[model samples]
Target: MTSSIGVAVIGAGMAGKAHAAAFRAASTVYSPVLPEIRLVAIGDVYAPLGQEAAKRFGFERHESDWKAIAAADDIDVVSVVVANSLHREIVEGLLAAGKHVLCEKPLSDTIEDARAMADAAREAEARGTVARIGFSYLRAPGIAFMRQLIDDGRIGDVFHFSAHYWTDYGCRPDVPISWRYQGPAGSGALGDVGSHLSYIAEHLCGGVQEVSGGRFHTSITERPKPIGQVVGHSRGNVSTEMSPVTNDDYATFNAKFERCVGSIEVSRVAAGHPNSLSIEVFGSKGAARWSQTNPSQVEVMLHDELGDLAGYRTVPLGPAHPHYAGGWAMDAPGVGIGQNDLFVHQARAFLEEVAGLPEAESLPRCKSFDDGVHNMEFLAAVAESAAQGGATVQVPANAAGTTNTVGTNTQEVAR
Candidate 1:
């Protein structure tokens, strides 16, 4: 087994907290495979929160500046959980500093930034450093299995795919504006939550070559506090007043894939639908469905006219499955894994990378920096296409070069 390594976290809010839990949980799950991991550092712009997180998450140190963590001597890995605008810089800097980085999605605020992140990853790879994207859904047990099934032809010749991720988070107008409402807010739903659909599109269906899409941003502005104090220790609740909601509330796109045609939707304004994320794959011989809310079970639709009636069957998945967490075995189904487990499961993909011989693991189940760059390119192309009245736009040859941010400012998608 590889020796234990030091890890650092670079955000103090919700995601930072989650990664801390996952880092600690990884030890139990990765026992015989991965060596011990020491969460050596935690960083946040808010210094007190960083200190508090260090204590709560058992980090060896805390700093207000992420650069301090990046420049630290003992750091081996960094999890970039900061805001969208900060993603590119932190990821690039961390990787440049010789630390493996797991950056939260969209890679950057713009395609340009995403490309920079991807380029940084490529450079890091050449220098033997590891980097991964933060698309957490790719770690879903059922989704992973589904990918294998599709690869093995369990679903013969996929011709179509329909994926939708809907949440009710944006339905409340009273919900004050956050960073998500501004210019290219960290990938929007397209990059924020929707990248999962796009990633699976490439992973499960195929890479999209062309897209004709339309986007929606119902709340053009928000009502966050008209003014708030930025005083230290009393950061006013900027989430309390009014601000223009500039991001899209939803986005729908039609894509031309290598072997399939599909529709993708990502929305945060789907009223009454709180936190529902599902993907459906239809093939010539069979189909399968995975729901984030029902992560423990995957619905497999097999049409064997020569056998049973054509219907989708529910399959219970648990520890019996390969790559499952330790001590988890589904006796008779119904036992479900929550959002927390997905993080642990996702971390396993990294362990595989850390253990594999060089170049053995090209891509991970979670979004890779390359994947983030690719998704941003696709989104940029789609927005461009939509802005031009839904014309088909060719995807870039590489994810590292997108100079246009608003040449395609068609919609602000719910993230």
Candidate 2:
């Protein structure tokens, strides 16, 4: 049977390509498990890139603008891969056009904007639309295993957790500057990367009750231009003229979750690492840590009071795992999955929903827009705290009146 929901993908850059591939991969990925992915149209401001991406990814057509795609009669779902600053305009347009939307992380450039987008999404849901943030790590097989472990009571009464994501490429003066360097460009270490860990904490533990944080702006605020012409993906074009860099290069936040206390560190100038992200959760019964550097394996450590010894473990991703479907289980344990694999899995989940199955039945449980907003709000608080010299701030009291009182989460930034 033909799939019911047609997909429209906006943007054609790194993440756009990944999302499109994931939508295509979702078909073969599920096999006997999920629904088909109908590629209605791929949208990009650059027509050639859009056409090329469509031809490469099996999209039925290409459009020069998202507005055109959003108006398509066949396009039922839209994936917004535009810049953070463009999220509000594009997403609001899609929602008004009666399309479900999947947007990339941190929601928007500002907390208020994020809240508005989230409110729009929530409003759309009442009319039967779904809005999701592209926090793809939540779909990783290893991360799914952690979720399962926590559900099985294997982790037991989660006590504490910590996560960190770092990369050193931006620190190099030779690297060309992009929107990532501008605070108004919807770019920064906190929103760009910390949102990943923030979503994870909110999902696995609970809403953050509060946080104390410090965000650092680097000394090298601008750089020299390269000797080449550039294309577009910016407010104007991806120019190489020497421009200013205005976002945080490093950030650290201390927080208290509903049942756990933790810290999150995000950076684009960590020195030598590239795309390093890891999360460690310690509970009363056991503890586990997984890294994005190695997407296929999860290390676990079980408590042993009687044996008088404790050690970590190595668990392999398998078919039994959430995101690791069929052929992937055949790969060697040491082999890994790429960043796009998470999107592939995420698309598969959406396909399942489109086919009339429920989200609970899909793999890689997708995050709702509300969930995304909660994380964004916490991030805003962190940014605020960080700006105020890592001031200790309390999370807004939960609506359910469930407050967690934890005391070990004080950090002085060690300045």
Candidate 3:
């Protein structure tokens, strides 16, 4: 009904800036044109950070309080990028105000809060508002293309999925403690990055049925207490005082899907590797592997290849890929894309759905709140298994008694 949608991003930290920049770029990508997106404001409790983000990202203004954003009539959509413990309060308030929301990942600090937020989303949906979770890595062209191939039976009956996400952000023992290091056991690296792995594993394969062989380790047992606010992974000012880390710095687990098994490893204390995530899926017919280090290509082996030529071939993403045709600036092979571009694609998708465009006219719909809840359940299962000393644990069934599958919208894939 509206010709233009007003947007605001709360929490002007690292991910918050990404959301703001994404909205600024959303309208420029893809065809069939999205409704005008107004960069209304940037909200963050830290006035300086919010003001800086607003100016840099072209927002009209900055607000120090998130409640002001919820009450503003000009804003129609908001991206909640605050701390996990703050998600329920901020999201529920925005939903009550009839604003569509795209929340950052892991849903909430706990499954209980995630479920409550989902209930709020359901109520808000009845009023024509939307709520979605941000799983930006899923927008990677190679990852999306891999899902398409599996769906089309390119790799028949996936038997094994192996994935590992490693980052050196917390490798130093001197890194100050922030919310990232403060949570229940299994919350550190597992909840931070492992959430992405769990969702991606399910997206390519199927819903996870159970998990076992869960292990968690904290290499840096304690860190200096930050004297002031810490942003993202940055270690701002810190006192000589130290605080005990209550979560794991490293976690590994095994998952059982409907028809396949998976292994996941994640760590924030990894050295040398900075933001390295790789996945290899083996199927009855062949295998495929992709890595974040090489985001623009996938290496695949298929049964169709003859004996002498049978091996993995590199497939560079191009106009022929799932989201590359009109989703990027160059829109051509080897032109390449990166992590920030994924945020652009994700932003465009969220705006399309918020515009109420038909399925045929929109990009893939963002993952629903129910899907977010299912993701939380998967994380909880892994945590439970870790607590039980690597004993097998069943993933809780969805309230709808159905597998949680992300909508690929392969119809958008160019042949």
lDDT of each: 0.69, 0.72, 0.89
Give the local distance difference test score of model 1.
0.69
| Per-residue C-alpha lDDT of model 2 across residues 1-415, encoded as one tens digit per residue | 3446688899887788888998877766544554445788889887888899999999999999788987899888788887788999899889988888888876777767877887898788888777777678766778767877776788798888889999775767656666677784214777778878887776667778889865556645775554442233222233456877877777788898777789888887788787899999998889999998887888988876346556887887765555554534344455677777778767766656556564344454356665666666777788678778889877664332321111111110110
Q: Pick the candidate with the highest TM-score.
A: 3
Flag clash pairs in model 2: 209-395, 210-395
TM-score for each model? 0.85, 0.85, 0.97
lDDT of 3 by residue, 291-385 (tens): 99999999999998899999999999888878777776578899888899999989998998888777676777788888889888888888899
Q: Model 2, residue 160: displacement in angstroms?
A: 2.2
Q: Write the per-residue lDDT of candidate 1 for residues 33-151, one digit (tens) a residue.
A: 56677789889877878888999989998988888988888888888887788887778888889988888766778877777777778889899888987567655667767776677
Error of 1 at 101 (Å): 1.2
Candidate 1: regions farther than 4 A off:
226-241, 305-308, 319-322, 325-334, 351-368, 397-415
Segments of candidate 3 deviating more than 4 angstroms: 400-407, 410-415
What's the CA error at residue 125 for candidate 2, in Å? 2.3
